[model samples]
Target: MKLTAISALVVLSKVISIAAHGGVTSWTVGGTTYPGWQPYMAPAGQKTAGRPYSSYDPILNPVAASLHCNNDGNNGPIPQSITIAAGSSITAHWAQWTHMEGPVTVYMASCGAPTCDSVRSSGLQWFKINEAGLLSGTVYKGSWANGQVLNSLEWTATIPASLRPGAYLIRFELLALHQANTPQFYPECANLIVTGSGNAFPSSSFLKPIPGAWTANDPGVLIDIYSEAAKSMTSYPIPGPPVWSECRTLKPLSERC
Candidate 1:
């Protein structure tokens, strides 16, 4: 999820500097003004009272990512979304000036009707792990679509072959994060999906819960953990955005728990 100056909030975060206000700092969202606890932005209408939070500013496709202040703690997404193509690769980068003494792992899922990385599409076999689990490798998640190729880690990676597409879904997990002298906040999440081409694929036959594990994401799908050697991303779905409760339902979709 990227943020662009949509309404009052976006404008406030970008413009109106509160530097002159001493210890008190302010952040701008949609339109209303508020304190900067955790700078947040939603899909325009998703705004409300509270610390509107997000990973980074959504102005343009980010060319650089901060492993130090990302969601490794409990604020940002472990593996944020990105658009990629067929026959390509995407990597996850972190570890600069933070305390996250470990690396991140990249996981791939399937799309639903539109070729998501769910169990219904190609299953876990459709996904693969490069570099195994090397944060230093830089290139963690990589694969070939059909035509073009993706060679960069991003907030959102699209499938290549912009024309002749197939079924695919991507998910990332942060096994470890930078934990230095600062306290960081982000989301402990695992929501990585992308609608594929044509119609949805078949349902995955492995839809069942593990003996000791619990999850709200798609079940039955076999996920290929790029590397068990590296640390996995921590998750904290509680106390989410206000929109989560409103949009959440006991739906029987393949993507939900």
Candidate 2:
């Protein structure tokens, strides 16, 4: 009986660990819903905007190629792109999210090609469009951007009103800080065909690469959010370049930004 109970406990622990992480399952644009890639299931060959990833597990290496999306996003089977007017809003629906201490960011990169299906994310230049971090309270126990996402199970980002029309890749990211010693990044990408007559594009200075934007020792990436020093910090330096000036103004999430 004792041995059986021990085995049962081990099995339950494994199940709990597996359920602790999650990934985006679908996206909504202009009242229409599109499915996201499923890591565990074979490709359904459906027309979707979301890109395929390897799993729901978080990417621990800041400089890994996987940082561009999650995993296998660059090489996986490409899904059909969705068309949306510039300045529209798109929402990502997660399978589940339990971590709360983190920032939520949205980035975009024009494919400069006829189709984004063949474009490699590494060669593209990315620019931040929206970001949210430590919204209230101290870093140790603040109302964070991920907390908002966790509460709603969804996160919405608006396309820049002045963005140029073209094929683009939109990246959605959440940086979980519960384990400050090792920051966790949950990133996903989707293909989009933005339609508009506007001709605004980010300058060279504003464009940043995924793995190049963050370093392992960056202050925001390596800080201890639960430490005594963090308790007194009212603001956090969200890791990444500033949002493009041509983009819409973000509602103040923190004074630091």
Candidate 3:
């Protein structure tokens, strides 16, 4: 009877953990909804036909950030691309997100090719557009969790108004720290074709390359959210290059840009 009770508790814990796994299933732009990355998809599988690659959970490697770029066994970018006007907002809708105490960021990179379908991560430069982390100096405020929007189902970010109009790849990442000791990463990417007259572009200081942009030991990536909460923590570090200054006017659940 005692052993059975212990096993039941263990099973319950596992169920809770599994319930927390999630990913952005689709995105909305200009009121049109598009399918998102396929978490755990095979390179040549039919299900991967038109979707970007991604992993649901249990895979956490920051050094191999490119896998999060388009996934699909690193095959290449998806054929279809989304079009958006400069300064407009895009919303990523997740299947579900159970753990809400960490950072969520949005980034963009120009597609080096005429089309993003064959674009690779090498030589690609990325710039931050938006980030959300540590809301109200606490992960939880009343009944809400930090960085959560649309009941934790969607996250919205605006494209830089002055961004150079061109083909770009947008990457969205969410770091789940509920199990802080082994933070989980949920990074996904989408193809985009910007159609506006904006001309500003990020300089060297504001851009970074994937695989080199993030490190496994980044303070924001490998943190202990559980332990930090007990110390009256008020600030949290967001990984990657600083968000473009001109795009800092909007607010997310973060402490600073």
Query: In terms of lDDT, which candidate is strongest?
Result: 2
* Candidate 2 displacement at residue 154 in angstroms: 0.7
Q: Which residue runs of candidate 3 sit more than 4 Å off their true CA positions?
A: 1-19, 40-51, 65-78, 139-150, 228-230, 245-257
**Best model number under TM-score:** 2
Over 1-257, each residue of candidate 3 has an lDDT whose tens digit, in order, gives 99999999999986676466776778899899987655545544422213455445634777764444645323334357788898899988877676657778888888766657676645588888988777665542322233475266888899988787888888887777767558676777777888788777877888898767778898877777657463566777788988885544344536425
TM-score of 3: 0.78
TM-score (all chains, Cα) for each model: 0.28, 0.89, 0.78
Please give the RMSD to the true structure for each candidate, in Å: 17.0, 4.5, 6.4
Q: What tens-digit string does per-residue lDDT give for candidate 1 at 147-195?
A: 0111222222223222134433333323221222111222112222332
Clashing pairs for model 3 are none
lDDT string for model 2 (180-220, tens) is 67888999889899999888888787789878997888888
Superior by lDDT: candidate 1 or candidate 3: 3
